[model samples]
Target chain A: MLEQFGNFLVHGLVTGSMYAAVALGLTLTYGILGILNFAHGEMLMVGAYIAFVLTSRLGVNFLVAAVISMLAVGLLGWVIERTTFRFARHEHLNGLVISLGLVAILQNIALAIWGADPLSIPPPLPRTLEVWGIRIGEQRLLAFGLTVGLIILFSLFLKRTRLGKGIRATAQNAHVAATLGIRTERVVAVTFSLAAALAGLVGALIATIYTITPFMGGLPAMKGFVVMILGGLGSVGGSILAGFLVGVVESFGGGMISSIFKDGFGFVALILILIFRPWGLFGQRPEREDV
Target chain B: MARRSWQALPLVGLLAAGVLYPRLLPGDYFLHLGIVVSLYIILTSSLNLIMGITGQFAIAHAAFYGVGAYGSILLVTRLGVPYWWAWAAGILLAGIAALIIGASTLHLKGAYLAICTFAFSELFRLLLDNWISLTNGANGIIIRFVPPPIGIPGLFRFDLGSRRSYYYLMFTFALVTVWFVRRLARSDLGRVLGAIRQDETLALTAGFDTRRYKLLAFTVGSMYAGLAGATYAPYLSYIAPDLFDVNETIYIMMIMMIGGIRSIWGPVWGSILLVSLPQALDITPLLRMIAYGLVLILVMIRMPDGLAGFLDRLVSRLRPGGTWFGEKA
Candidate 1:
């Protein structure tokens, strides 16, 4: 029983890290852009596919391939912001709809190229660490470690970097940011690219643990949204806390309660949270604003 | 009066085409396509009431649709209830669901509401897929029993066993839905909904029970979606959890957006165009879906009002002071 509990904890942490990584991007983009990118998950899919091609097809190193994937996906994100989202930036609904459109386009394009079958890269680190009868995959540990490191690095960047200050300024008030000579557009582009890069890293990491598929992003994306809400829509720290909470809850729910409804736990939690605290656990009460 | 008659001419002609559709084509495939289109029209039109009119961004429409489909199918299959009764029950179930979901989440404006609704939709789908004993666990329930004929037995029984019958049934329902929506859009209720959509705070400040109106719109819209689903179950003769997922909801939303959300007639046009576009082009499903995505993005970016809005502009431009189709604005 203890062993099982430990295993579930490890599993939850691994999954939770991915959720955090994805939610970080989601929260960042939402904070800066003021629109939920419904297609954000597709970035993960695209990233994973890119890395898959680099490693599996091109025989590149996994870490190098992941970096390349992140850069490529970040560039894609910049292009998306410039082309599609830039046009509908004024209307939240239009942005949402456009993102949905991107989702379809990206998913279908992936489907056409990769087909419907799930693919997984051979684990770069195949060793399993067993401690007190609880075994944890090195890949899982690596993913969890990387996520924590990324979160720390991200916070430092936000706190210490000039560009990060510019991003925060833009997120606070685009009009003010622009008036202050911040180049709000550049900040938006940079934030989108950075968020996309985070998602891409998560995708590349996740590909090593789970089978990669075009549709793999959907569940994680949904979970990411749930986490984003739970973490207070724009709070970096809130997302980190909520991500683990959700992952643990989901793990236990699936392990103890029922596996068939495994994917449902996050949604149920989301609805319950929305009912009691619509503003989210960590989010401030939203002022009356046009959406 | 002269302009009114001229406008009615196209409507009359369209009605004539609808009535003569099965006969004009006389093929099972065409009939099938027509039924699908009609079903979509109902779905998209109903969605317009909430998203377009009431200004709620609930995307769990497919969940309500599935509830209706599954509710009716379960009743007919499990308890051996009459088809029509089951269908009615399905629609009622959908309404109740909408009421509950709307009551709880309607207070949340914008993206929060959208996410909440989306979560509900996924939850519903999960329930349908996981509750194996009840929903058969994604193997899906095949509807073996056909709906009994309507009208007087022996004198004139309109058997619903054929594609033509299903086509006409859906077509009639679609017409009724459009008419109902049109009426609602023109009525005080519609004006209130439009007001809410434009500015909820302003509407609330003006002594309108915005929540109640939003709930009403949501419930009514969901019921129609349920009606479409109930009808769809018998037509498809198979109901599955996957059929009513987020992708399906997105498709419905896309149809409404592409057709035009501002007017009732937008969905009617959108349904016809989107439903037939792929078939007409004879493209692969993948390529077709990609095209759909492109169209959705382009439409949202360029034509926020959709095809109906574009047509409205064109009509207003061609002849000043005369708006096309539904409302003046």
Candidate 2:
């Protein structure tokens, strides 16, 4: 039991990092746009499929495939933003409908292109590392290490750079940011592309850990939503923390209880938090518009 | 006075059509489809009372429906309670559950309320799936025997055994539900809910208890769903957790949106079109699901106001400020 507990924690951190990496984009979009991108999961699914195609068809290394996938998904996000989400009519409900429609379209496209069967991505490194009686797979360690490095880089980018500050400023108050000479549109566009890139990276990594399937994004997207709400809708820091927290809870909980309950935990936590806090763990009361 | 009578004519005609249509339609399959549509019409309209009218999104609507179904099914099968009493018991239990959930969560507005309600539905589903000793753990309890006779007692036994009778029963119930909502909409409570939906802070300043009204709408809407479920359990004769899923909630919202939200008969018209469309297609299962997804997306993108609202506007255009059924008295 002690050894398994140790194992659960190790596994949790790896899985949790991937979750945080992708869900961070969800946090940014929700904070700035206030629209739950229901297709966010499908974006990840697209990325994974891209990686699968790159490696299997082109015989590229997994890392190179991931980079290619990220660029492709980033381009897709740019296109989606310009075409679908750019229109400002009843944004929230309209975004929901459009994103949902996109989910179906993407899933069907994937089905047409790759079929419904699952595909696997071979690990970039074939070796495993053992330290202090802990067995760690090389691919998982690389994912974990990459995620931590990215988080640090992202934090630095957000804090130090002018573009990063502009994005943050827009998230805080788009009108004020625009008035202060920061182009809110550019900031929003950049944030959205960055988010898509992060989702693509996580998608590629996840494909290495698990099989790449068209339907894979649905569960993860729903779980990420639960995590985002729990951590507070727009708080990147909170999302990072809560992502790991959810992973640990799910890992240990699944190990203890049934696996079906794992998916239920994020939502359960969300409801409990909303009941008690309503503002979320780190969220502020959004200025009211209508009801 | 003549114009007012004209407005009444459509309502009267619709009720008359609803009553007579079952007899006019041939084949049991279409009748069965009619029953499902009517059931959804009730469900979607009841959901509209909370989401559309009150502006409080309650995705847990189906959870209340499931509670009603499970509550009555358990009472009838396990406790040996008669069907009539069991049905009432299920509705009451569901109503109470809704009341509690509403009181706790309805204070939240916007997406927060939606998230909370969604969580409750998920919780209910988990409990239903896990609680093996009671729900038989996904196997589902099959209701075997007919309850003791009701209505005409010995001579006119309530035979749930047949589909045709069930169809008429569901259609009549749906009509009564529409009438009830019509009355509610015209009431002062409806006005208050509308005000709250428009502006809660302003409504509070206007001396309206926005919280109370929101909760009231939630509970009442859920009660109607529960009642629908109570009757529905006997129709389906089986209860499962999937009936109360998030997708079902989304489907209800889509129907209401398509039907021209805030319109009284919008859900009924929308349900008739959307529900019957795929069944009429009669395609393979995988292609059918794909088709369903496409249909929903196309409707959302191109026809947001839905079929009924479009027709209503078209008729108005041709007639020039005239009513479809007749002019208001």
Candidate 3:
């Protein structure tokens, strides 16, 4: 029984890291810009597709393909923001409508290119090790390691770098940040690219674990939003904590309850949070209430 | 009232056109299209009540539409409830849902409310998808008989057997919904909603009861959606999860945005043109969606008021000396 529980723990940790990786970008974007990118997961989809194309069609090395896909998706994210979001950033409703439209546009473009079939790559690491009756696969370990590493790197970047400081300031108060000559637009654009790159990197990492399809982005994207909400929108620590918590809950829910309803838990939590705490788990309450 | 009667000439003409449409065009396909158009008219107009007029950004519309369709249809099918009574059940369930949901989430502004409602709708959709014992688990429920109209014996037995007749039935409801919304637009509540949309803080300061108005809009809007879905189940004779999905909600949003959020005719005309355009042009599904996305972006960026706004401008430009039927523009 102890061994079985250990296996569940390991499984949950693996899944949790991946969820955090995908959600990190989402929460950051929402926190800073006050705009939710509905098409954010499609960034993941685009990255995976690019990696698949490079490795499968063009015969590039898998590791190199991963890097290329991340950068490419980052560039795509930048272009999308510049074209669609830049003009409408101030108007929240317009930003939402534009983002929704972009979701449709990106999903369609991916569908047109990749079709609807599921795709996958051979695992980058083909070895498995047993740790106390809990077998560990190289692919899972690699995904977990990279996610943790990137998250740490991101936190450090926010802590030390000038641009990162600028992003944090903008998230706290875009108007004040601009008033201080922070170049808020550039910070926003950079933030979008960084978030997009993280999502893209995660897409490539997870492609080896799950089936890579044009529509693979939707569920993860929804879950990413869920994690962000759970963690409290814009709370980096909250996102990570909620990501792992969700993964464990999902792992147990799938193992103990029913797998079919596993997807529903996060959404259920989202509704409850909205009703009970619209601000989120770690978010600050609005200083002023209109009604 | 007499001056208002003269001002209502265009609306009367529209009502007459809707009434005469089936008679003039006797084609089954056209009549079928009419029912479809009416269904969208209901969807867009109700959505307008919340999103367009109230300025609440929400994405739970199709879920409400689904609840209405499933609620009424299940009553009629599973429990053998009377068809008309099932509609009441559906509308009631939808209104209750909106009331409970709106009350819970109304305090959250903008995307927070949107995400909350969206998640709630997803919950409803999942229940419909998984509760196989009840909802048939995505296989969906199919009903063969058209819902007969409810009335006293021998006084009226409505003919729902024919699509043309169904078109008239839809037309009557559609006309009524439009007129109802029009009346609401010019009423005290409508003005308050507009005020809330413009500036919720100021509206609150003015003691407008913003939450109550928002809740009212959300509940009434949901009821309209349920009514549309109840009408739709009979016309199509089948409904799967596909009929009421986020995509459907976005499509409705597109229709409302394209037509004119603030105008009654905007959604009506938008639905008419969009609903018939693909049928007329035979555009492929991918290209059609691309066009949808493109139009949404273009409209938001360039034409803030949508087609109605553009038309208002054109009419005003042409006849600077004359009032355009007491239109808001």
Count of backbone clashes, every candidate in sequence: 0, 6, 0
Query: All candidates' TM-scores?
Result: 0.94, 0.89, 0.92
Query: Which candidate wins on TM-score?
Result: 1
Q: Give the Cα error of residue B202 in candidate 2, in Å.
A: 1.4
If chain B of candidate 3 is superposed on the true chain B, what is its TM-score?
0.93
Error of 2 at A149 (Å): 3.5
Candidate 3 C-alpha lDDT tens digits along A195-247: 99999988988887898887788887877877887777768887888888778
Give every candidate's TM-score on chain A: 0.94, 0.93, 0.93
- Cα deviation of A267 in candidate 2 (Å)? 3.2
Q: What is the lDDT of residue A275 in candidate 1?
A: 84
Instruction: Report the C-alpha lDDT of model 1 over A1-291, residue by residue, as the tens digit.
Output: 999999888888788888888888998888887877889999999999999999999999999998898899999999999998888764776677789889989999999999999999898999999998889989889888988899889988988899988987888788999999998888988899999999988889889988988888887887888899887876788888889988988898899998877778888888888888777778767675322
* Candidates ranked by DockQ: 1, 3, 2
- Candidate 2 Cα errors over 4 Å, as ranges: A1-5, A88-90, A125-130, A133-135, A155-163, A172-190, A256-260, A286-291, B1-7, B143-158, B281-295, B319-329
Q: What are the candidates' individual DockQ scores?
A: 0.60, 0.40, 0.53
